[model samples]
Target chain A: MNWKEFFKNLKTEEQGCVPDETRREFLKIGLIITGVAAGGSLLNVVSVVAEGLATSEELSKEYPYKPHYSMVFRVDRCIDCERCVEACRQTNNVPEYGWRTKILERVDTKAVDQQRQFMPILCNHCNNPPCVRACPTQATYKDKQTGIVKMASYKCIGCKSCMSACPYDARYFNEEKRAIDKCDFCWESRLSKGMKNTACAEACPAGVRIFGDLSDPNSEVYKIVHQMGKAVWVLKPETGAKPNVFYTIG
Target chain B: MKRIIILASTLILGLSGFVLSEITEEGVKYQESEEAGGLEIIYTKPVKGVLFSHKLHVKELGLPCESCHTAIFEMEAFKSQRNPDFIMDSLYKGKYCGACHNGQTAFASNTKCATCHVGVKGLERLKKKAQVLEKK
Candidate 1:
């Protein structure tokens, strides 16, 4: 038989196989009338179905990273001292015009308690980074091991596509390096040298930046993110970059 | 003719007053010396490097020289470091910068370690800047 006739025959067989009212009446009278009698057997069927669904669900629920290197900003603690910026510049050999990290001053005279606040910003090191996708030569790509978005300086063509694609305004063109430069969580300068934290996080006198492995349960980053009764959020979450950098009040 | 000249001079004086008021309204004040601005003091006692800006305190915060100069800190630079108690503990005890930086008046001396503590790197930067200024 052709495909249409085969589907018609399959539908007829399915309808004929199912006993209509007798099965419905048995479920209603026998199952509904006896609470404890039918309840245990129904629960077993429900649990079996749930287990089957959970096994299939595990494929999509798996986390992408092993270490999952991430950073968090305790935003309210920042004082706009620019010490983190200076430390980053000195450690990374960043030129005067460019900065890998920066502190943005927000002043509102009408604000209660505090009229001025500072926001420290840097590369978010997103799980789905737009810069990695935008780079034509694969100059900017996420590290497979640590998941840090890093630069392969030689492959960079200075096209500036990654600069435009970045939602956080993180990337800057370096004249001396002749490539796009951004915060690589100090992997090149410090992490490779066995240092535990980024220069910016270490330089923060206010305890503003908390950098740690997100995958580690004992890490400060994981604790802050997983903690209850705390409002932790990421910047521009609607962009779907899945940024690893988190922000909170304290 | 005398009445007309008086009217003309009064008009000129009124216009000058308007112009002078506009200048003052912009918050432009004449400084007696260039040293009154951009003055940085580095502390290297218990810590490697710490920075204090005179412009922020004197100009922005509107604090007078007497607020810190001879009271909380001595007039001489790096003199506080000579004392054995010139550390964060001292600051917490309301000594040195702790008098104002007690978290009530300003940020607590105990908090924001990197804000003032520029570390050894900041000290090197200051030295480089001084060298460049000396060359100029």
Candidate 2:
């Protein structure tokens, strides 16, 4: 409570209780236990690339959703064609002022040859979504079966808390809906009708966007994320949202 | 008669036009003199922001105009764009830019996509640059 009472109850450091060698031995044992828990999967053991960046989960702990939906962007292949953005607009009926997905440009003058790159971004549908946590009403929620962050327009109070909470800049307020709206991986448009992929993923002529169930071993998303061949990463990983969308070069 | 002929020639030269490519950030001119080197080309069909720098191919790589012109590309800029067949599929099949970009003569069209595909941002940047130059 108060400073005086807090100081009275505070415990001082108990030094010389354990020797340095003993503490190091305990640490080594802890590492071994963690290694055993990870099942010696090289990517999991090394925690290189996607395993380390996308989530805190060990290999065994991943794919929590029943048919975990995920997306991977082969970023090098993207030319900012904006076809994916257009497809998303028509398919979802997103307002002209709003967007479900966007392409970002990074321009570097010092780089040799090509000095510009385009990056397309959308809802990461994070396993530990801050937006879901910030929603006072049950308006925004992460789906159980597919792990998509969805919005219930009727329940929204237009408080705009979830908009600020999102790390990916994914959510947008729709005036017509009178609520917040976000990318649902086309769950409402096509996936519910047994379509195989999102409108964006299907519309990309460059094969830049790969969308599939992360839990299924046969899926492309699972293969790309699991392999050590190419480095895969998520945006603002330090925020610890555990995003489903990963990015990598072709 | 000579005075009248001179005035007509000057009018033709002015009407022909030339692009004023300023010194890029790398401190290299993307085009040479107003009369010699070709202009910078940006494609906006099928996709946007695909760039073709003549200075890179001609000046840096030392390719003569005949290497692409008359045989591969016509001297006219944006003329190939009129063809409906001018797409990536055609390039992969050893047509147009693919004639040189087929991995043997140069890097393949599929590889290093951003090298030429400057993107929508690049298109906007070029437009902005032109506006800024006009204001100056």
Candidate 3:
């Protein structure tokens, strides 16, 4: 009743205005429309929608996180210059022993056409974050708002459980911080300051990393992930973490 | 006496092999030869970790030195990288590696960048190999 109106009024420009379509759709379902969730998302509102009205496609394709911070890589364009790595280090003050992001090189001499491919990887910020689940202290978690896998460093007990829990090997124990450190999609260093893109995305000369709001259909990340022309894949899909990071080729 | 002479000859042959082309632990061939096995050049400018294999171009493709040497590139290695014009944009406009890699003659430089890039990881790998070779 008044709660919906109150929230609607409270909706600042930054949090994004909820489209009338979504509001109407949620209204039709007779659900409170707190938030729309994507595949494997933590929101309870989606379960209600899935129970009656929404199709599987809508369930899977919908953006669960507001601003749905995500990254897509044009891997074919990546030269693995490590410029992104250096930028991330400088921006985040990442130690030499610890890495928030890195490039993995794959060379298959027997492969047809180009035998070398470089894959840049960071925290996937999985909707169903095992690292978050494994953290007894809740030191690492998936933010309900931005869906970024963030670290509450002070809360950490120097546990390495999240390190083993992460399927992408994205987490590392930081001796300096005495905490588990991973990519927060540059939230602390950039996005939190109203910056549009991550440090790595900005540093790439090859346009390999495209970071943006995946929830917004207009965003390049949403279009690339939804597009049919090129293959878009996430690392370790079988792990079923529902990673926000996606990979594509030129 | 015969064994000593044979060993000496083998050492000479090994030394001669270094004069033209040398192979790394990864089997990537590097050379600065007039006939074949051209030098493998790694570019740190524009960006880091771009590898150009002379074996891939001159030896594997069997292209003559005249195709690139003294025309598209100087006989010197990394000399082209010093030129401010030596970049992917210039290649796209039909300069340097772009001369033959323009999709008409060879694969476009824009496509499959990792094929040449080898990246910073590749550069470090090469450096480590150099250090190991020195130890040997």
TM-score of each: 0.58, 0.76, 0.77
Q: Which of the numbered candidates is closest to the native, going by highest DockQ?
A: 3
Instruction: Give all candidates' CA lDDT scores.
Output: 0.68, 0.75, 0.74
User: For this target, which candidate reaches the highest lDDT against the unseen true structure?
Assistant: 2
Per-residue CA lDDT of candidate 1, range B8-73, in tens?
Answer: 999998886422111111111122224554356665545445677776688777788988878788
Q: Chain A TM-scores, all candidates?
A: 0.75, 0.78, 0.77
Worst 10 residues of 1 chain A by lDDT: A42-51
Rank candidates by lDDT, best first: 2, 3, 1
Clashing pairs in 2: none
lDDT value, residue A182 of candidate 3: 91
Model 2 lDDT per residue over A1-250, tens place: 1223332342222123447876565444344323333333324322222444444244424556867888999998999878899899999999999989998777677988666677888998988888999899989998887888999889999998888778777888999999998899999999999998999999998999999987777788878876665666666444546678888787
Estimate, for each residue in A114-212, the C-alpha lDDT of model 1 and write its tens digit: 454557789989887878998999999999988899999999999998887787778899999899999999999999999999999998766889999
Q: Each predicted complex: what DockQ? A: 0.05, 0.55, 0.71
Cα lDDT for residue A216, model 3? Answer: 71
